[model samples]
Target: MSAATVSSSPKITEKMARESPAEQAQVLVKSRICNPNFIFSIFSNPPDSNYSKLKYIISSSLTEACNNSVLLLGPRGCGKVAILELVLEDLLEEYPDMISVIKLNGLLHCDHNCALKEISRQLCQEHQLLFSKMASFDDNAQFMVSMLRECGLAHKTIIFVLDEFDLFAQGKQLFLYSLLDAMQSVTSQAVVIGISCRLDADQLLEKRVRSRFSHRKLLFLPPSREDTERLLEHILLLPTNSSFPHEYVTAFNVKLLKIFADYKFKEIVDTLSYSDSTVNHLQRFLFSTVSHMDLKSGLLSLENFKAALSTIQRQPKLEVLKDCSILELYILVCMKRLEAKEQELRNFNAIMKEYKSIHDTFQTSNYYARNVCLRAFEHLLQRELISFEDNRGHGQSAEFRPVKLLISRPELYQGLKSYPSCPVSSF
Candidate 1:
């Protein structure tokens, strides 16, 4: 086949197609996962009932401190993006003629300069008539100032919602300071709504910027297990005729939801789908006469679970392993490592070294090994089971240190105990 034709072909195998309905349902559900957006759309809108609490707070701010900024700080996946979308919808209704909402996700632009440039570019493109005279300027900061001037002259209010504000706070202190200063100097009535994973006390905004936002309300949202369960139910209710069994869903709630509650709703859905695939694969390995009930409990048993681990370890190539849902394996492996060390936190280097030793003994590189390890780390981080600290200075390699490990998987940890450690600490 031509390269183009080969690339266009479906990658999943025929065997995967014949998997259990539950497994297929998991995959179908996750395949429809949506990337969080800032726009106010029908699919993205929050339930009206959830808005009452937030509306009062925002309305109070708009009435009392029209010029000051509001900062919403919370843990990741605590509905910051949803709240912003809801607020945007509210702004449209409450201040239709007077205000315009501009939303931006900071993570999309990795660099400070690039972020500001894009923001300016977007504003100019969005309000071409108002900014046509100043469009020739190459300086983004200057362009932003001019745009603010125009907004002040024409609109009663302009609100800028900076989502993922923590990304910018990490190394873009100067950029934030300058933006705040420029906003403060604007003749037009303007305010900012900043959303971040860290609270204001934990953030490093400059004194001036901090003071500017002082009068504005600061709301902190912490993730709750209840919210996660509710979110799962919401997702399961999406498909018109989803065949995901209630028993399977209940198992997910008990075994996975609590452990992974800190993850974004989408992340949790992806992990569950991967786990379902793992369960399906295990079932296929069993004899045809074995009841599905026996297979289910067998896969959950310590001995059979270890056997599955062995199967993963014996995989000759990473490519094959990756295609078979290595994320589930990685999670199991990480849990096992934590149990073996009896440590609350597993250093990144230690985990990588252990994996290298295992690979060496097998005389092969598992294609998904490195990526699986990283995904596991990300999962722990998302769950707040681990806190990763990257000590590398700017433009240097990042070193990861896991601060904690939540769930314990003893079988996986025992498997790693047999492997020798690698020399490099990069992992």
Candidate 2:
């Protein structure tokens, strides 16, 4: 695999030159590495992999037509959800007619009522039943239990995937209790699989709910540095036997290897991994890098990764502050000034007082009206530039609620530098 082979291939060069930008992109898309579906094959379950362990548990329960429950715990990007999906996908293929799956997320269906409504909705969709919102809590509960019984009678195994499982443990734990209790009945054959980022997720369950659970937990951790490097190579290196010309594939892989060995590229990867070393973060980074590929620059280089790193690492809060009105910037500056003075329990009221002090001291002509400043404060809150302290009661007025600036000093400096109409002399 040498650069000379690529340059010597006149046929390949001619074909590339003749192809339009869209046509070249289509060619690139044909590469197995460039396609998401094809890429997942590289991540499929191995003989002794975690994928196999999970598949064994879920598949055995489905085969026996028995109720079972297990929890998957890992930090974000550890492939907890991905592995489950892969296992379930293969299992569903093996027992398509006998298996059904329902997915619920903690972020969306955290509340018991909302979760029940969503479960009813999903069950209705899956079974082709006309879904109607039941009028009472008892009616909805009965309906769900009846649906489970119906599925069980028909020998269909229902698999429930609860994402952010810890959130479902909130409140009265009614959802968790009801689902687990239903699993206990002889008429129900269902498997509950919970996925959570928290390692102590199992400890969060109520005593009753925990008693019904199978006490099986699978933990996932982020890949080590070596594994991450291997993943990068696996994703970027073109297949030798792919549709592309042999010379092009070799040349592309060679360039990719060189880029991987570069210290600058390693630095970029380190910077990304320092904050978030998850597969999800790597996916986003790669997606950005790959988007820069084109007919002219068909092969990736160190520059592409550097550019992608810059784009991904940008602070969105700074961008939002740059677009803010002058009054809003003034409020933020006041907060920064108050922070510098080591003031304690600063809130909207304190910010206003600080602003007045500055206004009177400087006699600034652009002093925004008090009502306008109030509106600006509200706008800042909405933008998440400032957040109210959690210890403050909900009934407390907004003006008196202790607040903190979300942006750092460096970000503040950067944003002010970019604001074209910043009143430098007034401050």
Candidate 3:
């Protein structure tokens, strides 16, 4: 028998497929670490729809391993990846002897043949299969498919996971089609879960690939504003170092904790809300929040989250973005939506067109006066946030280029989540 595959986290583990019960238990001991950074530990009872789905999926995966083929769809930073990690961990524990897993990222193997060969390589290496040393790509892939099927028929399980799944759709869905197609004839079952960040990824799938699982999917929508607050609140209230032996402690600082305790829900949302940020990304950002602040008897202030956000995205100083005002953010949003290239000199007329279109769409009559807009544009130039071909003059209507876009469109969208209630929303 084979064993577990590659791992992203130390907690989601695999034991030798045919190892003794004692040996398998030993392999899983690593999961007992008490550090809160282990995301699989923090995944306990999240306040969202994923809990039920995870319960069902974990149960079904243990019961019917091979036949599970899930397509997880969501945007960046969402907890889509974490959800899968939990599922894999559960399956590993439930079917130590029967299950063996391999996870690969779509971005790593954009080519279909490369993707297959890589998957085959990982499986072979872990299982000590003869295909590990095989030279021919076609021969190795076929052997892998056969071995996976044979395992299923033998009442053993094989799980294949592809992250960044959209990238793997390149080769006519060759890798996906081959792996999934083989699962049908096998008796026990095998699973192939593909995860993608693209919203339109399903539409890009070829009919054959789509037909592999008859169009099965798991959509991971962005968290609602209320859910975002709950998530942050949960993180804020997570056990600190002295909070006792919680399996996973939330990363909190004394300074930050005090503010969270005192801030109203609306007040918290006004400060900490980030657009397009998922639990995964937020968790990562949260991990670094303590490092950004001073740790003293004084509790952390809400103002510190601004530094964390700026640091997370490698953006310019938060003050640079703060100086630009909401209308400035709207201008950045317009430019980004229009796909303004960094290399090209953007024309003022083009930007105004986008701004006009945005106002018409959102039905807002709150555009800044042309003079105010031009001054804002000139101010951006003075701050070195943007550039113009004629660097000598404040030519508002001329073509200009963004030199230091402190906040990107996606980040701006995130910032806009608390808009209108925003500091400069009044103007």
- RMSD (Å) per prediction: 14.7, 9.1, 10.6
Q: Show where candidate 3 strays beyond 4 Å.
A: 1-48, 61-66, 132-134, 238-258, 261-269, 274-276, 292-426
lDDT of 2 by residue, 105-213 (tens): 9999988888878888888898898988754666667788998899899999889999999999987899999889878889898999999999999999999999999
How do the predictions measure up, each by TM-score? 0.46, 0.67, 0.63
Question: Clashing residue pairs, candidate 2?
Answer: none
Whole-model lDDT, model 3: 0.59
> Residue 371 of candidate 1: its Cα lDDT?
63
For each candidate, the alpha-carbon lDDT, in order, equals: 0.49, 0.78, 0.59
Question: Candidate 1, after superposition: displacement of residue 291 in Å?
Answer: 22
**Local error of candidate 1 at 371, Å?**
33
- The number of clashing residue pairs in each candidate reads 4, 0, 8
Q: What lDDT, from 0 to 1, does candidate 2 have?
A: 0.78
Q: Ten residues in a row with the worst lDDT in model 2?
A: 1-10
